[model samples]
Target chain A: MHPIGTVHYLVLSVALLLIGTFGVLTRRNIVVILMSIELILNAANINLIAFSRAVDNVNGQVFAIFVIAVAVAEAAVGLGILIALFRNKETVLADEVDLLKW
Target chain B: MSQFYTSTDHFVLLPAIMLAIFGCAVLLLDFLFPEPKQRKVLALLVLAGLFFSGIGLWRQYSFLTSQGISEITAFRGTLTVDSFALFFNGIFIAVAALVAIVSYRYLELEGEHRGEYYGLILLAQTGMYFLATGTDLVTLFVGLETMALSFYILVGFLRGDKRSNEAAIKYLLLGAFSSGFLIYGFSLLYGISGSTKLRDIGAAIVSRDLWDPLVFMGLTATTVGLLFKISAVPFHMWAPDAYEGAPTTVTAYLAVGSKAASLAFLMRMFLGPFWNMKEIWEPMLIVIAVASMTLGNLAAITQNNVKRLLAYSSVSHAGYMLLGLIAGNETGIKGMMVYILVYTFMTLGAFLVVVGLRRMDVIGDDVDDLSGLMYKSPGYAVLMLIFMLSLAGIPPTAGFIGKYFIFLSLIQTGHYVLAVIATLYVAVAIYYYFRIVRSMFIADLVDKAPLASSVGLRVGLYITGALTLAIGVYPEPFLRMAQVSFGR
Candidate 1:
């Protein structure tokens, strides 16, 4: 019940990052993997904003805005690639996209 | 507003701006000239863009030398114009030009010769420029994404091929995932420094406790991200697959151009911000370097696919360059730069031969596909031999010069164990590299088809092959350039 603090935001964002990393590693669906990447990106955005406020500096906030724009671009490219894969392979499952072997 | 900008800023940005303008022009002109025959002009336009960009880089170099300064900062220090950037830009432009030239015939063969392909190469080179020059976190992150996004699209340029599609998605997922790690680290760095500029962050880190958890976490995350970009071991799962599946021309470009840019970025970050905590990161990189060399060489021995073999070989090359950095001496840094330049030509030359083998029916990526290449095309077969010998770090080739400096640096730094281990891997590398040679000369022909030769392909091969030998024979000038670029 103490006033919200930077440490509190750090903990929350770290949790989101861990969850996103976990999702990306464990998920089979390429779409889910892409969403997990978004979560990780948002987690970074939250950290940037929180730290910006803590330091009374605006660069981190500006960085967060850039991060948001970049995240959108990344998602667009990821999905475009996804659609292409689907067109050729007829599956969005990561397991099925395995034409090239290790 | 007048005070906020200056001629220096415009001057520093001119090269990248030129690349961007040409990139867009290529894209727009493609729309006007939809015919495949006309699309060939786009390749020439890309070369022109690269040519002009090279001129811009030369102007920057002359300005620095004439002013008797090593570097000039622009956009209020967000961008830096320096020998280090100029050196790497030289590599990127050379790689892009070679790739563009060879791509014409390959794309025509694939029937996917579109304008966007050349456009993306220019745009990616533009991104690499920022990566080499950017001193701010915002600039670096955007630059990395620009380069990565273009490569992702290019990897999948063969829209009809499933392998290309799969390679693109894998590359995209892993690349985006790595970027996530990179930005999370950058956020922590900003928090710790209260600024997004790398110099500010470095200054702040100098004052902080070495073992601070935030410092440790930020360092680890950033290292992971950069390592992933360079395809270091444990984070290199996407490399072989991407290299094997990508259009041969794009694969060569990705292997050389992208790796060179990422190495520039890595050197900037480590030597700039995280340099103070060398005690922590040096050991970590040591482990990564050893693992990369050991695993990369060992894994390569079993590959029948020449593309995958070269892919693994590149992974090992990354390890050798890391050793140069870990030495952390002037010689070590100079050696790293020299190695990158040498590696570019040899690797591209090797791939150019493979590209020539891509007849209308032949994928030509298998080891057996190279059987009796000596008999089929003696010019290309001899060129491939020089490339392989160079790759194996034999004397009288540019690769030996690179490896020699790297090992000498390690020995000078008293990393005798690491140097010996790295040298041992060259033996392993030779085993695989000669496998290609054996196939080309000793093995019987599987297919007697003549290589799909064109003026552009032959020209590209000649440039790469000649440089590979020229640098090896008279490395003094190139070595001096590397030393100068290292600012010594």
Candidate 2:
């Protein structure tokens, strides 16, 4: 029955960021890695929306809209890339594409 | 009173909207005229549209100011028409136009489709235009991503090349990684400041607890996210690989477009939104600046591929631009502006020369590929020298003057130690740039070179080369323009 506040946004971001970090470190699937990025972006959106209310400024939501648009574009372009890469390499393991690593 | 005509009347947005329109037209044109010869013609038409828009915007600025037009508000405060955006827009569009011309032959030599590549180039330029004038963080973010999205596709343009695909993948992965960091920072800033509007955040910070450690941490984290995009030392690991792997044209785009957009955003984020907490960011910038230059320059010395070498060189140049940021004066900003003008020409010119040589099978970016470049193509060799010397900050080239002013601006702010380190790195940079020069002149030719002097490529090279020299010799006019544009 506890009401959420700024702290709730913080906690959500922390958890979201943690999940993203875990995905980045442990995942082999390229698509999942990209999905983790979405989680990270959503965490940002939560904070922005929370702050928009707290500060009483309209710019926050506007900025959030831009973030969503950018994220959608990113997801589209990124998945297209994954498709292209998969077509060529036949697998999605991050470790498999190690030929160019410095 | 009027609606349709004023729909695009937000003075700051004119160039950006024009660019987007141009992008759409380029796409449709490419679809209609998919043949190689037709594609070239369409590319020229798109370039003409971009050129007309660029000139129209530039001329409008002079006319408005001379007539003393007062407060012509178009978008109801979402934007403002100013000299700053106009100047940067010109630079972005001009660079894109030149890149499109060079890319015509670049794709053709690789036996790739010429149709949509130039369209994407125009689209990416549109993104940069938006990013520069973005008064709101929302606009800024949108502009940035539009630019980045276009690049993701362009980086992988060469379907036949493994290096191109790998580069695209790496660029996509790291790019997405940075976006996550950027959003996280944005959220953190919003959380503490209680606003996502950039100016609102500035206002909020003034009243709120400046000494609060949590708020400070949030802002710092946000900077880390943005700096990764700019490729400062720790965050710069992806640049070399991406530059080495992508096709040369995409690399040129990254070297110019990505870096320029990040710089414009950095200026806005710091000067517009976060200027209140100078103490927090000043030291952070100094550390990043010093680290970025030393690491980028020292790394460039060992690179074998010319593209990778320029990639590292660019990271070092980012350090110079950061130095201008740390100076945090009108002159510093002006210096950064002028430096961008010069850098766009020379850096892109360097890549163009590489594309030209690569087309001739003379050089595909191996340092040794340029062995006896002077013997086979004297004109290209000289053109390459112009670019290298400019990049090296040597005399009689735009690079030198640009560096001098940036360092001068910082020194005026009494950051003598930082200035000294920056100067020393400039010395180290000379060695690498001269290495390319030495290869062109000193190394013996390995094989009989195949060379063609296309009128378009030669004209493009001449224009950029002449600009580099002109900026070096008579920089006063450009400097004055930069000062006026940056409102000194």
Candidate 3:
């Protein structure tokens, strides 16, 4: 109900970013990490839409749409890749991949 | 000249639409012919369809100019049809052709699903073409996603390969996270400015210091997200695994076509909408550019896998391109365009050699695998050297010219310190690049694979090689053309 301010976005951004960070740093499952990324994107979308609504400009919303589209596409390819990788490594843990580590 | 705006069906926008057509048509063809081999036929058709249409678009260059087809377009002023877009599209088209030709050998021998593979690539190219020419944020996003999504699938196309799959997954998750940041930035700008059009945003910021800190933050976050896409240093963790895991041809597409598309959009964004904010983005970019270069080169120095080395190298190059954008001058922009063109050739050529080496279960990926390439296959060794030297910025190669233009531009802008660092790294780069060259030539051949290729692939390699050499030797034409091409 209140006109959105930067704080609202900061809170949402912090939460989403924290989630993504936690997932990336500690997640055992690759799929879970990916889902966390989606959460982060959704959080961004929320912030964008809130700001867009506050600013009354369509660009933010338009960009959000593209973000969604890209997210879907990225997810499709990512899962396909995951499926492929699991087929080979038989595990989804991030630590399992050391084929190219220095 | 005032022909149409509401039509949304302009021939000027044919490349964008044609991609969707090719993508869907492949699906339809697959329905009609379900056999695995039929996928190849469909892929060929998609490539051919895109090729003919792309050539058709190129032919209309004169007509487009004379008729003022640009001014007669819709979306008000959100998109442009200037020589810049056409020039970029031309590069993209040439790239698509190279990839398409390479794919014939790459996908077939590697036994990837032709329908999904070629269709996604065509679709991605279409997105890139749109993104390159997109005047507004909306079209740019749409185009970028179309390409990005396809790439996600592409990076993981060889689902059989664990590394490829892991790479794809990592890229997707990180890529999406970054997209969120990018969109949030766009929204903040929109909120502050009340416009999606580049000109509108620029005009709003130019007339007054009404722009706010939040907007700057949004922009920075967005840049961070996109930084990942181009595989810039901090955002570059995904590239090596993805590059190594994905099919070699897909790696080329990511390195060449995808990066080109993103950079084109970034050029417009920084030089156009964000131009007024140069004081803000410049120093920030310089920090990033330095980081990307130093990190990428240093990391590359430690890599034994050829694919991973190239991946890190590309991340560093993306940083280099950013230097041009950081300068925020016409020369800076032109340098970026020139470097990208050269980058496309050198990176793609290097990858083609990688693709050439990947035979049966043996992917010609590791540094050790390249040992004694001189005796095993002198031709590939020479090609790899062109790639390595070009990458190292050696003279008589496109990489050198690309780096030279950026250095020249940076020096012109009084970034002597950064230039000094970049040059030092250039020296550092020589060692790693030479490591590959030495391995290919000096070391003994541990494993030798037959250089098997039909005429088309061999011809493709020759054309790519010749272009790499020709552009490297005589870059004036490219520089002039790139300068005259876009909204600048």
Candidate 4:
């Protein structure tokens, strides 16, 4: 059996990031957009942990933990803001929250 | 050889640690006294914490300079204390202090006097300190996110208002997207170099003579994230809404504090680890600089909302600072530092004026709100005139001095065409900046109500107003400080 390699990990990471980005850009549901952002962040974690294994170093793994903590905090704040918006507007569609614009 | 840790290792983080502690103290104080009016006490407490942190930073700065130590790296290169970081630390601390002062009465009148506001501001300042000083990519990422997350909550602090909620959500969605891009870029950088420390990354790239598609992609993604934070054109869609909808004081803090912090991070990252790859990133920055100036000034001309107009003006000022990066030399960096310092004074002073006019009856954020302001308060009107003129880059103001340094640096670097274009936009900017002035002095009074004033707002105006004029008159000390900030 062939060994797992950096290339394989990077391919998977990039794929996840692209999918997440696509979802964020295309989706209108605020909840889905938040989830998409989480996916993008998890994609980064995958890259960090994979590169940590390949590089034989702990820095990337340490960074991955930090990333996870920050992602959770971001999600909490993002949801709080979303809830605030929903309370006032009664909907979470991105287009409806258009009280401010050019 | 392995290195041993010592007491000095912890000393380097003293300012940030102290600031974090102060933030927690504010939270505790708020828990004890949950009354809205008690928020003023919390604000004063935050100021005291800021004062102590400022003194700590000053002592560290003095110690380092006195010992002739140009750089001190601690926590195994994750953090570096140097004049560059110290300079930015001072700016961030000053901004936090000034914002606290200005927000006092503004929050009281808006009925949004929550203790979390001061706590979050202090927390955000700590994050900014780390972002400016972090020498490791991991530290930088954490710091940036810390600052950004605090801002997300702060922007929506006025949760009762529909516009504030809208601003918060829009800023969050866009900000999170950009952070994803930034993190992915950092991941790629780590993969390519196999290190997260900036010095080690520079060494690895130089040793391998590395250049590849991945590197370019990573750099581009990182630049995009930073440009968004600074509200540069093509990435400035969130700024105007965020600025206009946020509580006036938060908008000022967001405008001056966040931009300076991100640019400080950008300068460190680009000039340190990626200096070898300048050719790849420099052209992209130049294009961003040009687009930001043109689009920012042109769009600002049509804005009737004063906050939105200043938001656009902030974008254009970001463009001017980017020119310093384009110069890509020592003088350029010095000029960038001076430009940001002066920009902080003028922008904050201008925003504080907007906040000064705010009352329960009137939002006081519209251009028409300023009509006949001269008749109501001659002192504030004169102060606004000074800030407006400075912002227009007219002579005898710090804004002019800042622009002069940037253009001179550009000319020194043979960016003649860019300088010429920037000057033309400065002319365009004057037209818009003067629009408010004309309304204040010439137009009929829309509402003859006496302008509401406060002690906090007055102090803020005086400090920033004096600094703007003083720097313009005697720029030698600031210029010298900028020169010394190379942190060599």
- For every model shown, what is its TM-score relative to the native structure? 0.99, 0.94, 0.91, 0.98
Instruction: Give the residue spans of candidate 1 off by over 4 A.
Output: none
lDDT of 3 by residue, B1-488 (tens): 35454554465666676777887777667666566655657757776767766865665576677776643244677667677677788888888777877776667677765577777778888888777788776777677777888888888787676666767777776766667667656655565567777778777767656347766666787687667778777778878877887888899989899898888888777777777778877778888899999999998999998888998889889888998887656777778888888989888888888788777777778888888989988888898888888888988988888888788888998889988988998888899989999998899888866765555466667877887898888888887887776455
lDDT per residue, candidate 4, B432-475, as tens digits? Answer: 99999999999887787776787888999999999999999999
State which candidate has the highest TM-score.
1
lDDT of 2 by residue, B234-290 (tens): 788778888887878778878887787778778778887688888878998899989
Q: What is the DockQ of candidate 1?
A: 0.88
DockQ-best of 1 and 4: 1
Candidate 1 differs from the real structure by a C-alpha RMSD in angstroms, to one decimal, of 0.9
Model 3 stretches with alpha carbons more than 4 Å out: A1-26, A55-81, A84-90, B1-9, B31-39, B67-73, B207-211
lDDT of 4 at B282: 82
Give the better candidate number (1 or 4) by lDDT.
1
* Steric overlap count per candidate: 0, 0, 10, 0
Please report how far candidate 4 places residue B283 from its true position, in Å. 0.8
Positional deviation of residue B373's Cα in model 4 after best superposition, in angstroms: 0.6
The alpha-carbon deviation from the true structure for residue B14 of candidate 1, after best TM-score superposition, in angstroms, is 0.4
Q: Write the per-residue lDDT of candidate 3 for residues A16-47, one digit (tens) a residue.
A: 76787677668878888788778777776776
Using lDDT as the measure, which candidate wins? Answer: 1
User: In candidate 1, what are the lDDT values of residues B348-372, reduced to their tens digit?
Assistant: 9999999999989889999999999
